[model samples]
Target: MVRRVGESVEARLDAERERIALWLPVALGAGIAAWFALPTRTHWIGLLLVLGAGALAGLLIGWQRRFGRAVVVGCAVMALGLLLVWGRALWVSAPVLALPVVTEFSASVESVEPLPAKDQVRLIVRPLKRPDLPPRLRITAAGEQGKGIAPGEAIGLRARLMPPPTASLPGGYDFAQRAWFDRIGAVGTVLGDIGRAPGAGDGVQTLRARLSDHIHGQIDGSAGGIAAALVAGDRGAISEADEEAMRRSGLAHLLSISGLHVTAVVTFAMLIAMSLLALSRRLALAGYVLPLAAAVAALAGGGYTLLAGAEVPTLRSFIAALLVLIAFLLGREALTLRLVAAGALIVLIWRPESLAGPSFQLSFAAITAIVALHESRAMQRFMARREEPWVFRLGRGVAGLVITGLAVEVALAPIALFHFHKAGLYGALANVVAIPLTTFVIMPAEALALLFDSVGLGAPFWWVAEQALNGLIWLAHSVAEAPGAVATLPVFPPWGFGLAIFGGIWLLLWRTRWRWAGAVPLVLGMAVLLAQPRPDVLITGDGKHIAAAQPDGSYALLRERAGDYVRDAVAEAAGIDAPLAALTDLDHVACNRDFCRWTQDGRTILAARGRDRIEGADMAAACAAADVVISERWLPRECAGRWLTIDRDTLPQTGGLALYLGERPRAVTALGAGDEHMWRRPPQVSGNDEAVPTTSLAR
Candidate 1:
């Protein structure tokens, strides 16, 4: 019986060998993820690459066992990925600013993005006179200060600048890492009058910028902004309210120039190319028009990508589209798992840091799941039926769209929740209308409008495009405003998210019944999320904001006027749906001019919000009396608490903290001890740092 079981297990493993190569990218991504997970930098590229090469050499030197070879090759690929990211990190390293600066400086503009709504233009400038500053800086200029600032122009201006900011909270968006990769060490805001902004932003000088400006000149309101986004990838003109609606309705993807937009542009280019080339009977008879059409489509799509800012998502889509066109020319199958993996590998090799971003995750996961579904036998059979009635074919197409949308949503749930703390409850249904409208109507019309503008016959097309965009905007707002449009749920912990992603990859890649095993981990991940508990108290890096849990199960803010970003972050972490309430409004907490004190479940939390209003000795006595103490200013050395005490001296190392209350209380911090990443600049401590609980801090 044991021999039979071993043979069955071997047979099952052997049957899954066809997809062994597909897991190579998964391994590569894992290696890159491991690099990011480390608290400090690793410079072992040569060692990792050597290990990978040695493994390959071992496989050639009489190591012929199939399972051993598979394991060796997987490890080898992972090592290569780690090596690539390590090298990339070193290549992109730049000095970051340590303090805020307010000085007049001159710089040559490298790029400009006009923002009509805010009456501002963002500039990426190369510093010419400031050797003390980083090589590059990203600054936002007012409409008056940036009246005609364009690329290639040298300009002088006074601005206040600061270093790229770290994450506002644990698992929150970290802009510092992105800035490091982009070589931007400072973010600045121009100092000027808040006068009327340039109307529709007419100062841009590049072709893409000019086109975007002209579109805004032609159309009005949010319609013009939508049109500009489609053509030039400038979203600054879009109103924040409309942008929020798009996000809430899950239609925001349409605003980004990704797969849908690229595919549409390529198809349109191919049709126009074939039509023009087919005018020659010689080309058609020689069977050369299709290949030429593919070439034309690739060129056109590449140009559009450059014009659209070449963001990560657009680049991914462009690379994928270019591959599909090449496959057409070579008479090879398109839309395979290998194709998806190839695109991902190229992206990872180009910018490994993108692996941590939501755009990269969402785009790749959506495409991978869609490709796997299409390649399934059931979907293939459904597509193969050719003798059906027109009605049946139409019905099948609609059903396929709905199914694909739903599948993509399911595949993205963990990632979405992990990042946003909410997912659209009815996004699949919303996309059924929005995708077609954007793809078949708005994009085509916009292209026509641009194509005809040289001959002055484009106004009609522009009008039609505007009307369609208005309808799309209306649909998004309606869906976003409806009841239960979004589901607020607890975001997954890092481990849970990793587990779900692993299971998803397993389910998608393996082409056998045993693939059902993947569902076990998926279920386990969901269970972890459902059982996760909310942190009882929250504090920001600056020690200016705090959130405490009240008896009524609501989160109350220490500051009555907390910004939306802080409030929402606290609310999400607390697993509450409502906005945060003012801590003063809670009856359990007692407040004075100096500090506030609250007692709950046999524990006391004392917070010092006003330093000028209290004496340090008195504050220390108050802290000693409470079980927990939180201070905005530096805590007195003798004021250690019964359970935990945190203040200005430790806030730099902690970055942010989330405290739990109970008999066995714990504290979780955003930044880990001894983290030496370029972005984390926690102050040095000479063995005097407070010792946080290892078990809680590890999480």
Candidate 2:
């Protein structure tokens, strides 16, 4: 019996070893491919680490019955590996920290978005980071500096061009985190008024603007015109309603020149080229013409896509399109899967952090799912029934739509919940209708608009395009505003994110029988996310109204001249909104009283300090015998005395103050709290009032 058991265990181990051997090479190849394609600041180390990790994972998982243990260990190892990758990401994406010396630089204004306030406009300035002059510096025109610049003007920029800022809000959308992966730093804006009219040439800027104008004129403010803008990656013309509708319907990706948009455009253009070439007499010429046409289309899309902020998915799609065309030109057999792997390997090597981002994860997952779906028996059955009947075709089309929708939806669902805390309930339906409209009607119209603009016949085309855009907008709005359009979800943990990713991977890889395993993580991720708690306090006000508590549990606000806005903001931030009225009920104007008095019914009284002249003397008297005296204004005049002045700026105009009353109630100690540790007293106060009494009885 013991010998039989030993043999069984050994057999299982051998089988596991065989499985590992089969998969290890593929994993290494993928990793090695990625290492080569990605750009690394510390090149050799990153390459070595990736290969070594791949090898380690392969060796560790070589035993068959140890699948569960191997998976657990592999996950732990990957988590550690990711930490190292993140560190490298930080170094490579170093933001420009120092200020730039602006000697001289010139750039033509591309476009501007006017902010709600008339005085400001968000200018997307393309400053020549490197100039002929020695004093010229690379500066980004983001945040405060990026505002108020206009198009067609060459304004000088003199400022620091540092790397992007770190994510300010923890667990929120980190623009800095994404920007670093993309190698974008802050660009400085013009220091003065527009100096010269930007010299015009027939570049992308000219073409894009002309095309946009022509479309606007053709559609005459129609929903279709806006749709054209969206399809062409020109979002400047889309109204707030259109934006809101797209967001709610989860079809905003259609307008964003992402993977779906780029792939659709490229695929359609390729099909047209292939069709035209197939009818040609010369086989050689036909082959060349088809590839050339596809190349031109890719370039066209690339130009527009870049102008519309080319994100990871758009870049990926463009690269994939070019690769496919190249493969055809080379007379290569259908090798799309290999090409996709190559692309992923290449992109991952360059930006390893990208693997962790929403764009890369969702796009790749969707593509993988599509590939797997096509390989399934369902797809084969549909292909066989193509010649059977119209009903078959109809059923197949619907199935295809459903399959594609489900794949993409599953891929992006995790990201959507994480970033927006909401899921588009009708997303599948919206994608089915809106995507076709944008791809076929809208994109083609945009291309025509560009031609019309070049020939100075832009207005007519713009008018016609606008009408179509309006119609699309109307449809989108109707769909988006429908009841149960979106549902909210709670935030998830890092582990939950991991589960979601694994779910996607499992669904994409497993043939059919074990594919159901993907749902385990998907469901778990959703469950984890929905269980998070909402923030109770929300603060929105200027600095002086209310000071935040320091590590030592003390808060400070301006004592002398406080406003209702500040008070309201503080109350909201502190999650004291419910008790706000009660705090005021005891004739207390502000909660920053020296002494706090509370009754059984939840009423609170703030006793006024001797030096501070509060709103109501009678109310102050009522709360005189208080549990604790928290100084609202400033540090006490005397540290060891009972006389407390709540006015800040009394000592020095530092910031705010916090006082922790010890066992000796009369012993006053000042806790300086604010941006700086300077004592500030209220300006309008007498010296005597501000002075501390040597000794005082319990009044």
Candidate 3:
């Protein structure tokens, strides 16, 4: 029996040997993710020890066969990943604004972005005279204050600045985290006239801005905006409604200047370069075809990546494209799985923090799944079109494109739910139309229009591009509005999401019959997610906005005056449409001048809207009787509720709170309990669980 088991184990190991390298990146990403999820950073000494031990073990085990060597290598890669992000976090750690400040200072503009709806321009500026402030400040200027401001200009202004905002609620997006990665410490609004300052800025930004403006000039309205977003990654002109529609239709990926756009640019550049060079008889005979074409493709992709601000998605896409071209130049068929893993490793090494973001997760997941699918024996055989009629070949191509789109959507669904609380189910159908239209018609026409515009004949092509964009927009909106187009879930446990990801990767990457075992965890994870109990009460981080569930299968907004952004976030988290009904007219709850009482299933919640209300209430009795008590003001020690109490003291500690009312009550926080991410706090705040004193948001 022992010998039989040993042989079985060896068989499994041998089967997976070929995939050992592909799993290295997965291990590395796991380490990086583990680091980010921790509430506190590991001690430097411990981190160093792990890194050293893993590396040494990896080297010593190289002579060992199969399983043992693979284990050591994976551990070594994971350690490397952990070390890379740990070092990065320490290196980039800097002070963030602790409080709001209003001051005057001169700054060198780092970048300029315009918002068309508000006629406002935004700038990332380095404050010359205010080193005490955050080094990078995002400032909004409107009207004459921002008129004609270019990227490299030095400007002066007085503005009121505040720390980058944290997540509005538990499980919502972390804006501050993103700002931290971008090195933006403060966000503000220009309060007065903008004046010329002492220095100039880089010209690369200026060039990008010019290109965006040129495209916007050619197309009109949101269609023009889509054109610009595709070509130069300028999404400023795209309206919120159109953007939302894009998200709902699953076509939002097209708008992001990621894999599709970069690949198209590289392919076009190579083919055009080769064809143009082939026209020259001498050059054709010289047989420099592939080399020169590959070079041009590289230049084009790299230039476009830089011009698109070289953001994570664009850079990642460009890296993958460059790898493929290099493989072509080396006369080897690039293995898709290896290419993806290599690209991921490079990007993670450079920007380890991106592993936590949706862009990185979604982009890589879609690619890995698609590659695995096509690499399958069944798909390879099904897609083979040799000796087939032209009509049959065309049909197969169309069917394959549609099938690929559906596969991508399936792969991306869980991730989208984890990040955005929603996923578009119809993106595959929409993409069958949208992707081909964008790839074959719109982009090509736009390029031709730009080329012809140089010689004063761009109008006809521009018109063709405009019409195609209009159709694309119409398709997105139409598909988005279709019944059951999107799948949504309320906030799910992150652990479940992690399990889902692991299971998915396992099923996709492994060739063994045991790959079917992945389905167990995949289903279990999604079940855990869908079965999570809904929060009865939702509170914003600032303690100014609140949401409560009503008995009639609906939610009520306590603070009726919250902005659209806040409302939308809360709504998404609750798995409902935004602009929730105000609590004022709700019939399910009883309200008095001092407090509101919501009761269901023999449990009660007492919430105060203002300090006056809290002062007037009988909190000791209320706290004892009620399942949960909530207020913005500090609650007395004696006023603890039966289950939970969230006030200024605890609210600030947690950032935001979600109360689940039931037989055994529980609470979830926006940053999770004891979260101490450096970007999430100010310089002097303690990272401990003890509450920090803070004032309630002023009425």
* Candidate 3 structure lDDT: 0.81
In candidate 1, stretches whose alpha carbon ends up further than 4 angstroms from where it belongs are: 1-10, 41-62, 193-204, 551-553, 575-577, 611-613, 681-699
User: Model 3 — TM-score against the truth?
Assistant: 0.93
> Which of 1 and 3 is the better model by TM-score?
3
Tens-digit lDDT track of model 3 for 1-699 = 955875675678789777768897898998888788766654434664776677666566453656556667777777778778878876787667777877677777888887764578889988764547777889998956777777666777778888888887878988888887787888999886777643432234477788888988888788988998898888888888999999999999999999999999999999999999898888889888888999999999999999888989999999999999999988877647888999999999999999999999999999998899899898999898699789999989888988898899989999998889899999988998898899999999988998998999999999999999999999989998998888777788889999999999989888889788899989999888788766778888877777887766567887788888888888778776445888867776777776778785567878777656343255687778887878788777778777777788887678877777777767788876656676765452111212322111100
RMSD of each: 7.0, 13.0, 4.9
Report the C-alpha lDDT of model 2 over 1-699, residue by residue, as the tens digit. Answer: 955875664555455452333222234333432432334435435655664575466556454435534443444334344444545554554323232333334554556543221233345445443322212123334335444344555554433343233322223344444544444344444453333434522223444445454445455433533554465455655666567687778777665566666766677777777677667768445456666667766776677577555656677777776776678778784334556666775565455666656667556666766676676677767656546678878777876877677767767777766655566777777777777666776666666666677778756655555555666677778878888876654333556766776666656554435557788997887677666433211112111232332222222333334465444334323322121322223332444444333321122223333455445444344434444333434433232112333333442222222222334322111212231100011111111211322111101
Q: Which residue pairs collide in model 1, if any? A: none
Q: Which 10 successive residues of model 2 have the least lDDT summed?
A: 677-686
Candidate 3 ranges with C-alpha deviation above 4 Å: 1-7, 42-62, 198-205, 611-624, 636-638, 681-699
- Give, for candidate 1, the lowest lDDT window spanning 10 residues: 689-698
Q: lDDT tens string, model 1, 396-493? A: 98888888889998888787778777777677888999999998999989888988999999999988999999999999899999988876654346
Give TM-scores for every candidate, taking all chains together and pairing residue i with residue i. Answer: 0.91, 0.62, 0.93
